[model samples]
Target: MKTTLATIALLVLVLGWTSEAIQVQENGLSFSLEAVKRLQEMFESRGTVQQNPRSRSSSSSMCEDPMLPQELLPLCKQRGASASLARLAMVPMDVCEICAFAACTGC
Candidate 1:
């Protein structure tokens, strides 16, 4: 009985650690090389807009909106950054503000 209890305890410990690791990985931000390339392309196309004064206003607006992607919710929750993709909604996006927003909301 004692041995059985020890085995069970070990299993529980392993499972708990595994679950925590999985949660951390899932909640973390992971971008593939392809995604980075795509983001660079998008930023390049909107280079001029980024330089324009109007761009700041638009970026601020998007930063203010609250319709973020579901995947990003966790990161946002951890970071405590709020705001939606309202203004720069026009330009192709790459940065995941949703995670920061989610972190903000969670906090």
Candidate 2:
């Protein structure tokens, strides 16, 4: 039946996308860790004290911004690792999404 075939096709597409997401996550973890390592290296090279710049009043304000991921927010609060760095680390995954979208669009 057409419906059954369509259902099977959808299932196949779902499985494929899921696998792609898993692969992205695996790759993303390594990429994020490397980013953190590089940031640490840069800080050490600078010989500057690692202290978060945000004051108590600004801390709550920054938390409201959804541009930063919830999981990385805590790390961003730390002295060396910043929200910008965390955002930078996520760039690859964002690119992957764009590439995936382009592929889906037959571009």
Candidate 3:
């Protein structure tokens, strides 16, 4: 069991370190190398990935008429997003806003 786990870990490390871009798919799910690295860093730092000030995405840069859920408001604020654009709408625009928010903020 230990050996199996170790081998799996090694495989992941190898795949992740092989190049700047890592793409893998299994069981109909895909994973990104950048996301894997970020997760590993998050774990190593006890859930504290050093936040880069420049990486923070401002709300102004996000889509017009942002529609983030109330729960994500605090997280958005932490990531340097302004709440001025917040609104209550459920439309294609809201879906785009959610996707853009998740991608931009890495949530």
Candidate 4:
């Protein structure tokens, strides 16, 4: 178990070579270079899940409309299909108002 942990630690530390070692307690806590080499086998193995391509659809989604029930929706989002049409119809008026405001302010 200690050898396995030491291997894992060595694999994780990229700068372990430049550091000087010290024994705070004794030789009871130490990592073996042989153990680290054994753990390197994992990095040589092939990847399985990463090789597959992502799935996609070409058809237009009917989910373009909101799927929330009426009771769960907020006031602005709880409108019927006709309300959407009314908002769409207001676009020309909104543009006209902006034009009028800009003209009056010489903006």
Most TM-score-accurate candidate: 1
Displacement of residue 102 (Cα, Å) in model 2 is 23
Clash counts per candidate, in order, are 15, 0, 0, 0
Give residue 68's error in model 2 in angstroms.
Answer: 1.9
Ranking by TM-score, best first? 1, 2, 3, 4
- Each candidate's lDDT (Cα)? 0.37, 0.41, 0.35, 0.26
Question: Can you write out model 1's per-residue Cα lDDT over 23-68, one digit (the tens) per residue?
Answer: 1122345332233233334434546344552444443432333543
lDDT of 3 by residue, 1-107 (tens): 99999999999997767543433222223334343333333323432223322232433333222433333334334433433222111112233324343222212
42-106 per-residue lDDT for model 2 (tens digits):
43343322344323333344445564345545554555444444333333434444546221211
Model 4: CA > 4 A from native:
1-29, 46-107
Over the full model, what C-alpha lDDT does candidate 1 score relative to the true structure? 0.37
Residue 29 error for model 2, in Å?
A: 5.6
Task: Give per-model TM-scores.
Answer: 0.27, 0.26, 0.23, 0.16
Candidate 3 TM-score, C-alpha based: 0.23
Candidate 4 per-residue C-alpha lDDT over 1-107 given as tens digits, one digit per residue, 9 for 90 to 100:
99999989987684464331211111122222222222222112322112321111100111132432222223223334223222222223233233342211111
Give the residue spans of candidate 3 off by over 4 A: 1-21, 47-107
Model 1 stretches astray by more than 4 angstroms = 23-80, 83-107
lDDT of 4 at 106: 13
Better of 2 and 4 by TM-score: 2
Give the true-structure RMSD of model 3. Answer: 15.3
